[model samples]
Target chain A: MKVGILGAGQLGRMLAIAGYPLEMSFSFYDTSGSPSVGFGDILVDKGGSGAKLEEFLNKVDVVTYEFEHLPLELTQKIEKLKPLYPSSKSIEVCQNRAKEKALFTELGIPTAEYRVATSAEELAEAAAELGCPVVAKSVTEGYDGKGQAVLRDVADAEQAWSSINHDAVIVESFINFSRELSIIAARSTTGEVAFYPLAENNHHDGILRYSIAPAPKVSTELQQQAESHIKALINDLDHVGILTLELFETPEGLIANEMAPRVHNSGHWSIEGAASSQFENHLRAIAGLPLGNTAANKPTCMINIIAEKGDKEAILKLPYAHLHLYGKEERTGRKLGHVTVQADSYEELVWRVKNVATFLPGSPEFISSIS
Target chain B: MKVGILGAGQLGRMLAIAGYPLEMSFSFYDTSGSPSVGFGDILVDKGGSGAKLEEFLNKVDVVTYEFEHLPLELTQKIEKLKPLYPSSKSIEVCQNRAKEKALFTELGIPTAEYRVATSAEELAEAAAELGCPVVAKSVTEGYDGKGQAVLRDVADAEQAWSSINHDAVIVESFINFSRELSIIAARSTTGEVAFYPLAENNHHDGILRYSIAPAPKVSTELQQQAESHIKALINDLDHVGILTLELFETPEGLIANEMAPRVHNSGHWSIEGAASSQFENHLRAIAGLPLGNTAANKPTCMINIIAEKGDKEAILKLPYAHLHLYGKEERTGRKLGHVTVQADSYEELVWRVKNVATFLPGSPEFISSIS
Candidate 1:
């Protein structure tokens, strides 16, 4: 089968790599002229024009986007021509915080309390009403902590609103959570769903730096709670591929932070940790193949290589470290690659993850359920 | 690193897949006009001329071949310009049975008693001396049960010799063996070696149909014996990549049958069974990186999908079965792909293997140490 990806980034590259063994070929549509996915037939449609998009659509049997923030018109057009997994409605919802929050509310999934604001005065009022230290984020096109600011007090709302610079923003009460976690689940075209165990995540500078799968010390109840919420979202949207819901473990229960309408970084550990990788399962779901096992094979940790790869040889020396470079050049805060470390026990996995982290410059200290 | 593969077959395709995650790019030189490896910078060097060969060599930082039957002159020529792992000497030794047996003898490796014959008269005499029921194989360019014939009586020697139709042949007494096994080992440029567990293989019509890794009931002594033999060969050749030694487990001990200087079919199980796969380790070795852990993650069995894939959906539905298609058209007796099934216990693995085999048309009954 031929698959066309809307964004030719690392996620698309990994999806192609995973799908190749299934005898699936890929053609990547790079909206950004500089495509980092070094292989595959890449069409650079910088202008998102007529001929190139038509050519890409003609080449593929199905369509999926790695990035959710793509132009809605393009995805809708592609959907008209070919089957688009997760659908354009998924994109429309995930790209806007207000719509996403409304979906969570409609599905009875718990999320952070929030109010939409269209002006600085309204933002200040919402922050005052929600209580101080709220996070004000743009209603749309926000990711990786961009288009966001913190309101320590109601007085800081003006600066926060100006920093966000969007006509509308959502002011959410920041929940003081014990930890951050994410659940990745895949839904097939036949509507069969499989959920990977919750992964504990650690972010530095608003970028995911570490993720440990089967999140150490997670109880059956907690995992089920996370799974049920994501399942509701997936079923509600009639999602056809992977859908990720980021959550915060608070005193009350798991509260949804956000959802990504595609394969996520926190699920990257599945490449080595679980029986089947998220990338592979995502492809399998869209291709109408049966979903693979989602159980964790071992205690595994994925350490992101951001900005620079300090020492390739040192990391390679760690026998358990499975280094995956995206074939992207070095740049500040750019995710060049990731290394997955697995062990018989979480104790050993932590030590090995720490060993690998030492070779990645600017890597945050290893953090997870056990550490 | 840029890796140029000598053949664009399934092995080279898998090598490219494994190496891409390590930030390595691939270019494949297909001496045959038809290249099955679906992806990569494929250069069809059917003419074996100077310019195409030079272009291929120039594009790669290192070189390796998936198949050993390539023209030695071409390999040696490429070796002069690029660092070809396992070297031309490895190819020289592997392509000729006489030289391979001689090397085995020099290393004190046990094998079936054999003699070289130049003509039908010599072959008949050798068969008589060895007692009848001997197998005669061409001294060079033989693989997958090709260029061989068996003699049940002394009078059949001329027919067997004529059937082989080679200038020189090796006549050996056919020994009754308990099972066929193979050990895969990788040696790094730094001379560090790591060995994967021995795989118990079952062959049908001279093609490998199934392989069970860490070969069930293998005593520590037996594993060490197999490892030692492979290590000796790797060291003798100063090999810098994967070296596979196929063995016949007899009443006495293991007897060396043959060797391949690149990744072998039996090691395909490592892709999902071992902590590190043979293909990945092979690339790591050739790229001058440290070898990965070669320990089996679980009791695993690999069932080759010969000729035709019966039911892809059925295989995919088997959660533990990792299906790998080579993207080749179905042909009688051709290896199209394989499915790796893993279970926590040997008994469970055997059952799973049998379950997976049922969906593969014409698959031989599953056989292994446990079964």
Candidate 2:
């Protein structure tokens, strides 16, 4: 079988690697050639050129996208040519923050109070109703903590609206969650589902810095609650691929944050730590194959190799540290790759994660907080 | 760094997969267009065509071969153009049974008694010295039980010689070993060495059928003995890549039967069962990178998906079974792919191996012996 992917990034590359063994080939549509150019000998339509897009779509049995921000019109066209996983409806909900937050509230999945605003006056009204300290975010074209601003007082509403560069926004109650957690879940066309252990994630400047799998010291009830909410989302969307749901663990309880309808960065440790990797499971889910085992083989900590290429030799010399360089050019604040360290004990995992982080440039100091 | 490889079969394909994560690209020289044609877009000199040989060599930093049978002249030419791992001398020794056995005996390694014969008349004499039921095999161009014959009586010499197409034969005492075992060992340019757990192998009609990792129930002393011999061979050759030693576990001890100077079929289970796969280690050794951990993570069995393209869906459904298809056209007796099953115990590994084997065509009945 052939799978058509909308983007040719590391996620698509990893997907291709996982899917190849299962007798599946990939054709990617992207402007820049996927650095994984040599992974398979298939045509890549530059910039999703209309002529090449039609040709690419005709060759694939199924279609999917690595990045969720692909234009809805393009995906709808792909759906007409072939089946697109995660469904256009799911993408529509995920693309618009208002729609995503609205759905969560409608489903009774706990989320921070929020309201849509199309003007500075309406933003001011939303801030007044939600009280001080609100976050105003552009409803579209936002990621990596961009296109959003914090308004500490009602007087800051005008500046927040201008900072986000638009009135098409979702203004929301600020969440003072103690921790951030995410669950990597997969659902097959047959409705069979599986999930990796919850991961506690840490972000630096809106980019994921580190993710510890099985969320050390997390309560089992909290883990079950995360899985339940994730189950409801996948079922509601009738999704047939991997989905990642980020959540906030606040004093009140777990609150729905946002979700990515694709294989996630938080689950990359599964490549070496889990019985079957999230990449493999995602490929299986979309290819109509049975979902694989999602249990972790050991406690694993994945530290992102952001912006700067690390001292590979030093990182590799660290025992049990598996390095994955994305074969991408390094730019400040860009995710180049990651390193995963697996150990028998949580203490060892933490130590190795820190040791690995030390080899990479611009690694967050939070890694040294093992104490 | 780029690594040049001769013969783009599944072994080279796997080597590319392992090296890509480490930021290495590959350029292969093969007439068959390398079954892994998509691994990289670098030039592939078809049949090592003289016109393109230098062109191909100039594009690579170092050279390695997936198989040992490349003509000595071609490899000598490649050595002059680029550094080839498992040097030309090592390849010369491994390409011919006479040289290989001589080296083994010279190194004081235990091996089957043998005599190099150039004619049928000399073969009869070798039988007299080695005793009846001798095996006559071609000194070169032999693999997978091919180009060999057995003589049960002195009178059968002519038939045996004719069976192997006459001359250039090595007649040896037919080994009646209890079991077969193999060890995958790696050596870097700096002499850093590591060995994966010994694998207990089973062969059907001289083709490897299945390999059980850590060679269930093996004595630690026996494992050490095998490693010692392998260490001697690599150090003596000053080899800088992975080499595999296949031995017969006889009642007296172990006897060196044959060796491949590259990744071996028996080590495929390391992909999932070990802390680092043999393919990855081979890439690390060749790239001048630090070697990875070789410890087996779990008990595992690898079954060759030989001669038949099995029901992929059924095979994939087997829990914890990792599938690897070589993307080859299947013919009777061809190795198309393999599946490795990891489990908590030997019994469970054996059971899963059989369950997976049932989905493939022409699988052996010996898989059920675990019961």
Candidate 3:
């Protein structure tokens, strides 16, 4: 089978790696020359020539995307030529904050209190209604910490509106959650559904830094609630591939945050920790193959290597550490690679992960609070 | 780093698969159009042209071979341009049965009684001296069940000699053994050495059928003796990368049979059963990276898929089974791929492997004697 992918980034590269053993070939199309050039056979730089996109699509059996920000119009056109997993409508809903939250509300899924606004006065009204310390975000094309700001008081509403720079915006009530949790769910074309264990994530400057599988210390009841909501959302969207649902653990219950319609960074630990990896499962689901077992082999933790090129020898020498370098040039705050550590027990896993983290360039503090 | 390989069969393809994540690039040289052409960046067809050989060698940083049958003169020429792991001398010894057995005897390693013969009369004489029912093998370019024959009596000597066809042959006394076993070991450029657990192998028509890891029900003292012999051979050769030693279990102890100076088929279970795969460890040794842990992750068994392709869906549905397809056109009795089954217990591993083996094309009887 030949698979075509949009936005050939690291996710696409990992997907291609997983597909090779299954006898699947890959071609990629990206606006810029993507780093996937190393693994992919045909790279269509869409920025250089518009006609190459059609030529590339003709050679593949199915189409998919790595990044959620892919334009909906292009996705719909590609669907006409070949099957596109997760559907363009799902991406359309996820690319905009308002639409995503609205879908959650309509499905009776719990989410933070919010209101839509278009101007400075409207932002102030929404902020006043939600109380002080509210978050104002653009409806579309927003990621990381960009195109969003926290409004502490009425005096800060004007600057918050201008910082967004977009007329249409979503103002949401500030969430005070105990921890951040995520669930990765996969729905096959034949309607087979599977969910990976819940993951506890920690972020540094709005970028994911560390994730622990099975979300240590969480009750079984809480995981069941999160799985219920995710099942409802994927069924309603008629999703065909992997979908990641981010949640907030509050006093009441699990609250919905946003979702990504592709393989996620928080799930990288599965490559070494689980019986089967998320990248392989996602490819299996989209290709109409049987889904693999999602059982964990051991307690696992993953830490991202951002920007700094740490000593490779130091990381490779540590026991139970699996180092994955992206073969990318180092840039400040760029995710160059990650390391996954697995242990027979959770205590040992934490200790090994912390010891490995200290060898990193910035000496990240992902496990400081575990003690 | 870039590495060049002499043969582009499944072994070379697997080596390239393991090298990609380590930021290594590969080019292959083969007499015929290699199957690795789909995955490799360069394919030098040695049969069609001679000029491309130098051009191909110039692009690689170092050189290695997937098979030990590479021509000694060609290997010497390549050594002048780049460093070759295992050295040309080691390959020379492994390529010829007489030199290999002589080295074993010179090093005081226990092997079956053997005598070199130059003609049919010499073969008859060697058989008479060694006793009846002796086996004869060709000097070089022999593999699987080819280039070998057995002499059961004095009258059978001419037919056995004619069956071999080659004038240079090594005739040996056929000894009765309890079982067949093999071990894979690696030595780094800096003298770092690691040994994988012993594997119990079964062969049909001289081709490897199935392998069980850790050689179940064996005494630790016996394994230590085998390891000692392997260590002495590798140290004397100053070997780099991986070497596999095949042994026969007898009433006295373990006796040497043969050895491959590259990764062996019996070690395929290491891809999932061990903490690190043999292919990855070989690449690390050649690339000057640190050798990883060689401990087994669980009790494991691997079965080779030959000739016909099996039902991929049925194989993928089996729990804890990892399917690896070579993406090559199937030919009768040709190795197409392999499936490895891992489990927490030996009983469970055997049960699962047997269930999966039934789904294969040949329905091999390798696991029937486990009880």
Candidate 4:
């Protein structure tokens, strides 16, 4: 079988790797043009001459993607010939903050109360209703904490207007929280559900720094609340692939900050920690197959190595951590690799993972103390 | 870091997968062309031509292998340039039955009594001394139960001479073994040892059919004995990388049946079932890094899913059993994929593994009864 991938990034390369074993072939349509090109025999298609792109895509059996930011029209066009997972409509709703907030309100799902702002005057009113210290975000194409800012006062709110640099933005009340957590799950066409354990996350510069599965200190009631909210979203969306919902654990209760409609970085531990990984499960769901178990094996904590390795080979010796690299060419601050460390207990897993990078000589001081 | 891999087959593909995260490039020099070309950029070298082979070998900083049938001359040549794991002596011993028996004798490692037969007259005398129900095997190039025959009487033993094709054969008493088991371990140059739990194996038509980790009924004493013997072999050979000891469980204790100088199939479960997988550990050993813990996370049973899947996609949906495919184009009885299932206990694990294949409706009739 042939599958057409919408992007030629690392995720696409990994998809090609998974497809190879199933006797499936892939053609990658990349925007970057230099994605792990030599790693797999992935035919590159860059909308090369309108006719050529169509011709290459025509030869495949299905279409999928690595991440969002795909043109909705391009995806819709591809959907006319074959299925596009998570559907272009699903992508449309989740891609922009404004659209996502509207959908959540329409579905009666609780979200940070918000409104759209077209100018500075609009920000004051939205913030007035939403409350001070609200978040102002570009309605579209923002990720990793970019294109967004917090409004603490009238002057702080003024900066939100110039920063959006677009026709529209959304202002949301910032929830006071104890910690941040996320739920990574997959839903099939048949509504079959597979959910990984809640992973507690800590971030730096808005990029995920560490994630540990089966988040400790989480009450059973909180976990159940998180799952029900996630199931409601997947069902409401009629989602057909993996979904990641990042949430805040507030004193009031669990409240979702946002959601991603694909395999997420925060779920990396599943590759070695779970009975079956989110990657394999995503493939299974996409292939119209049943999902594998999402149970954790040993207590596992995943540490992002960042683009910080001056000599990446230093990690070749880490005792209990499993390393995963994206096969991308080097550049400073690029997400080069990750290490998943597993242990007999959650504390030990956390302890070992936090100290792992120090083992690599000439390694930077990126790791933060967990204790 | 540089990783030199021997025999570029599917195992090399897997090693490449394990190596990518370290940013450590691999050079897989195959006597037959680059076998893992589909998954990684494999630089092929022509073995029949001497200069081309040496040029290819010059590219890698170290060497490891996917299969053990290495050309002694080529290996020796490569050894002059860089280290060859398992040592040339271990390869020489494993390559021939006569030499292997002699090494076992010298090492004081126990084995079934046997005699070398190079002629039909000698074959008769060997069978008489060992017993009528003796097994005859060609001394070299024997694997997956190939080039071996079980005899019942004098007439049956006479045919063994021709079956051996007059090549050197060993005549030995058939072992009354309770089960087949294997011990996989990695020893670094620093003398640190890491051992995977013993795994019980079941074979069909001479190929490994399945493996059960933490061998269900092995006593603590027997487990320790198996580990000690493996450690001694590693120290004796001063072995590097991974060493897999295939053994037979007898009434006395575990007896060494064969040894693989690299990762073994029985240890594949470590990918998800242990703190670190054998593949990851092998790379660690050769990279001159520390070894990871090998403790099993739960009772695990990995059942090989042969190529005859009625519908490969449909059957791959099992919740707990992680599946790995060799990327080989399928054929009758070919090794297409394997399913790994885990549970809290051995009995439950075996039972759960049996039903794991129910996800594949196209599987054979017996699959339902013996997943």
Candidate 5:
């Protein structure tokens, strides 16, 4: 099967890697022009022209995107010519914070209290009404902590709104949480759904630094709760392929932070830690194949290789560390690659992760649920 | 690093898949005009000219081969320009039966009584001397039970010799073996060695049909014995990358059959059953990276998809089964792909393998050391 992928970045490269063994060919449509993935037939549709879209559609049997923040008009147009997994509705909802929060509320999935603000006065009123230290994010086009600001006081709303640089912003009250977690689930064309073990994620500067799989001390009830909530959203959206729901574990309960309608960073550990990786499952789901086993085989920790290249020799020397480097030049805040450390126990996993971090110059201190 | 592979068959395709994650780029030099691997930079050197050879060398940092059956002169030329893993010496010994047997004898490994014959009369004499029921095989370029004939009596030697079609043939007394097994080990440039657990193989019509890993009922003493024999050959050859030794398990002990200097079909189980796959280990060894753990994580069975495609949906429905297709059109007696089934126990593994076999037409009956 020939698959057309939107956004030719590391995720698409990894997806193509996983898809090759299944005898699936890939053609990547990169709007960024400078695609990170070198192999496969790539169409650089920088202008998103109809002719290029037609050519890409003619080359593939189905369409899927690695990045959810795609132009909805382009995705919708592609959907008319070929099958698109997760549909344009997923992109539409995920791109707008208000739409996403409304869907979460309709599905009974808990999220932070917030109000949409079109003016500075409304932003201040929402902040004052909800409490202090609220997060104000653009209603559209925001990710990786971009186009966002933290208002510690209601008096700072004017500055936050102006800096956000959007017509409207969603002001959300900050929820006190113990840790961040993410649940990745896949729904196939035949309506088969499978969920991977929850991953406990650590972030610095709003970028994911570490993700530990089968998050330690997760109760059966909590896992079921997370699964049920995600299942509700998946079925409601009629979503196909991988859907990742990010959560904040609070003393009150689990609160939905955000969700990505694609293969996510937190689920990268599945490449080695689980029986079937998220990349494989996503491809399988999109191709209408049966979902594979999502069970974790061992405790695993994935550390992002950001900005700079690590000592390849030193990292490869660690028997438990699997190094994955994207063929890209180093740039500040850019994700070059990641190393996944697997061990029989969480204790050994933590030790190995720390050892691997030494080779990565600016890596954050290794931490996990157990650690 | 850029690695050049001699053959662009499924093995080379899989090697490329394994190497890509290590941030390695591949340029395949396929002597056959029809290269099966679709991805990567492929150069079809069908005429074997100096210009094409130089072009291939200029594209890669190091050279290796997936298939050993190549023109020794060409390999020797490439070796002078680039570092070739396992070297030409290993290839020279592996290409001929007499040299391979001599290496085994010199290393004090046990083998069946055999004699070389240059004529049909000599072949009959050797069969008579070996007391009939002997197997006659070409002295060079024979694999997968090809270029071989089984003689029930000395009178059948003339037909057998003619059928082999080689200038010289080796006639050996057929030993009564309990099962066929293979040991896969990798040696790095720094002389670090790691061995995967032995895999019990089953063949039909000279083609391998199934391989069960961590062969059931194997004693630690037996495993160590297998390991030590392969280790001796690896060190003796001063070989780097994967070295696979096929053996016949008789009541007396393990008798050496033959050796391949590159990754073998028997080690395909390592892709999922072992902590590190043979393909990954081979690349790591050739790249001068540290060897990974070779321990088996579960009892696994690899069933070869030969000559025909299977019911993919049916096979995929078996949660334990992982399908790998080579993107090749099905033809008679051709290896199309393989399915790997992993289970926590041998009992469950056998059951799942049988279930998987139902989908693959013409697959041999499921058999293993345990079942």
Candidate 6:
């Protein structure tokens, strides 16, 4: 089977890897050439959207994107020739905060108290209602904690409002959640849901620092709540492909934070640890095939080796961590690479993740390896 | 860094997995798509031999190959573009029986007593040099124990010689060896040598069935012999990339059976069991990067999942055997996948490999309980 991917990136590279067992042929198209699409047949063209798209569609059996920001009009145009999963309409909702939150509410899912802030005055009013220590985010084009701000008091509201150059923003109460968890579920075109283990994620300066599979400390009730919301959303959207729903484990209950409409970086460890990788599962879903097993052989912890002004060799010394380095030439606060470590015990995983970075120049090793 | 591969097959796919670190990019170009090139970026065209090769010349920084049959013309054409590791000269030797044996003799590598036979008269003369029960093989294109026949007596010799359709055949004395073993070693683009642990292999009907890493019967004497021959070969050919030498262990000594000039299937267990996989090491050699550690984490036994006459689900029942299914859609004597199981003890490793076959059906389980 021939499968075509738009935006040839690491995600597409992994999808091709997953397709290896099924003998699925993959070809990729990207504008500037994705750094991570080092594997498979790739074609890079700098033409504008919809240019030569008909020709591209003719060569492939199916079309999918590695990213949500793919030109919807171009994809819609190609839809005439081949199938594009997660429909262009779905990307519209997931790309904007207002649409995503509204859809969540309509689907009867739990979320934080949020209000639309089209102006600075509305932002202040929403902040007053949501309380101090609130989060104000741009309605669109925000990721990796970018285009978001924290309003500690009334003082930061105006600054936060203007800081977002976009037309609209969202203001919500900063829930004092115990921890953060994420669910990565794949919904096939046929409405099949294959959920990987709930992942516990830790962040450093708004960057995903670590993720542990079979998220430790998650209650069965909380897991059920998350799964239910994911299923409802999949059914509501008639979605196809993987959905990464970030959630907050609050004292009140679980609350939705944000959702990525495609493969999430938080679930990268599944490549070696899981029975079938997220990339493979996503391809299976998009290709309309039965999902493979999502079981893990052992506990796996993935630590993002953020290259923050240092050499990579220091942390790569850890023998157990499966190091993945992105072929990014410059490393200035870049996601240069990640490390996945599978161990018999959680304690060993913690030891490896915490201390491995200490070998690097600037990354201060955690004092006691506590969350 | 950028590295180029002449042929894209499973070996190239495995290398891409290993190239996760070092932030390296490997580009593979096969005449046609190969299953191994499924996960990595593949370049294809009939344009490589002419000025169309100009687009690829400066693009790839270094060059290596996934197999010995890298077209001699393409290898020579790309020589001016960048360094081609192991050199095009080695292929001329490894691709032919007379040249391979002569090269082995030149390097003082212990190989079986053999003579080249291009005709019936020559076959009779070579039989005198290597006594009866000799193996007659076509000088080229013989693989996986195919295109070869056993000569038991004088009557069998005439039938076998004419049957080998190739222009010439090499007659090798069949040694009464107890077992087969293989060694995979790496030589950097500059000729630095590193040897992975020796692997003990078992074949069924002349096809590799299973391989156990850190070969159970390892002794100081055998280790020294294996390492010296590999080092000698590397220095003689000024070889680069990986060299996988297959051998037979007999009462007399270790005898070289055949050599694969790239990553071999017998070393697949290294992906999970060794500190660094053979695939990664191959890319490292081609990229001129520092090689990774190749020490075995634990003993691992791997079983080749062949599509025998019956039973498909039997392999899924084996515990701890990491199953890898090559996505090939075919039946009847096709190699579709493999399973590798790691354990603290050889008894456990052996039990897993032997009993894992039972999980697929048409076989009875013989694996013992932990107790």
What DockQ values do the models have?
A: 0.80, 0.64, 0.67, 0.45, 0.66, 0.30
Question: Cα miss at A114, model 3 (Å)?
Answer: 1.4
Best by lDDT: 1
lDDT of 3 at B198: 92
Residue B58 in candidate 3, Cα distance off native in Å: 2.6
Write model 5 residue lDDT over A1-371, tens digit each, in one string. 89999988999999999999889999999888799887788889776655577788899999999888877888888888899998999989988999999999999999999999999999999999999899999998898889999999999999998899899999999999999999999999999999998999998888899999999889998999999999999999999999999999988889999999999999999998887899999999999999988999899988999988879888877768788888888999899999999999888888888778878875645333237
Whole-model lDDT values for every prediction: 0.90, 0.85, 0.85, 0.74, 0.89, 0.74
Q: Interface RMSD value for candidate 2, one decimal?
A: 1.9
On lDDT, the stronger of 1 and 6 is 1
On DockQ, who's better, 2 or 5?
A: 5
The residue pairs found clashing in candidate 3 are: none
Tell me the tens digit of each residue's lDDT in model 3 across A245-342: 99999999999999988899989988887767888888998998998877678888888888885877788777598888777888878887888888
lDDT per residue as tens, model 1, A1-371: 99999889899989999999999999999878888888888999886665588889899999998999988897888889899997999999999999999999998889989999999999999999999989999999999988989999999988988999999999999898999999999999999999999999988778989998888889999999999999999998999999999999998999999999999999999998877899999999999999998999888888889889879888877778888999998999899999998888988888777777778776745333237
The alpha-carbon lDDT assigned to residue A322 of candidate 4 equals 71
Q: Which candidate do you rate higher for TM-score, 2 or 6? A: 2
Model 2: per-residue Cα lDDT over B332-353, one tens digit each = 8888889889889888787787
Instruction: Output DockQ, candidate 4.
Output: 0.45
DockQ of 6: 0.30
In candidate 2, position B177 carries an lDDT of 95
Tens digit of lDDT per residue, candidate 2, span A1-371? 78888777788877877776666778877756554544554565666566678778787899888889878898887788689997898899888898999889878899989989998889999999999889888998798999999889989988888889964989889889988999989999889899889999998889999888988878889889998999999999898899999999998889999999999999999998886799889888987788888888889988888888879889877668888888788889888888989999998887778777778877757566643
Any runs in candidate 5 off by more than 4 Å, and if so which? Answer: A46-51, A366-370, B47-51, B364-370
List clashing residue pairs in candidate 2.
A31-A47
Interface RMSD of 4: 3.0
Runs off by more than 4 Å, candidate 1? A366-370, B47-51, B366-370
Worst 10 residues of 3 chain B by lDDT: B362-371
| Least accurate 10 contiguous residues by lDDT in model 5 chain A | A362-371
Q: Fnat of each prediction? A: 0.80, 0.63, 0.52, 0.63, 0.62, 0.32
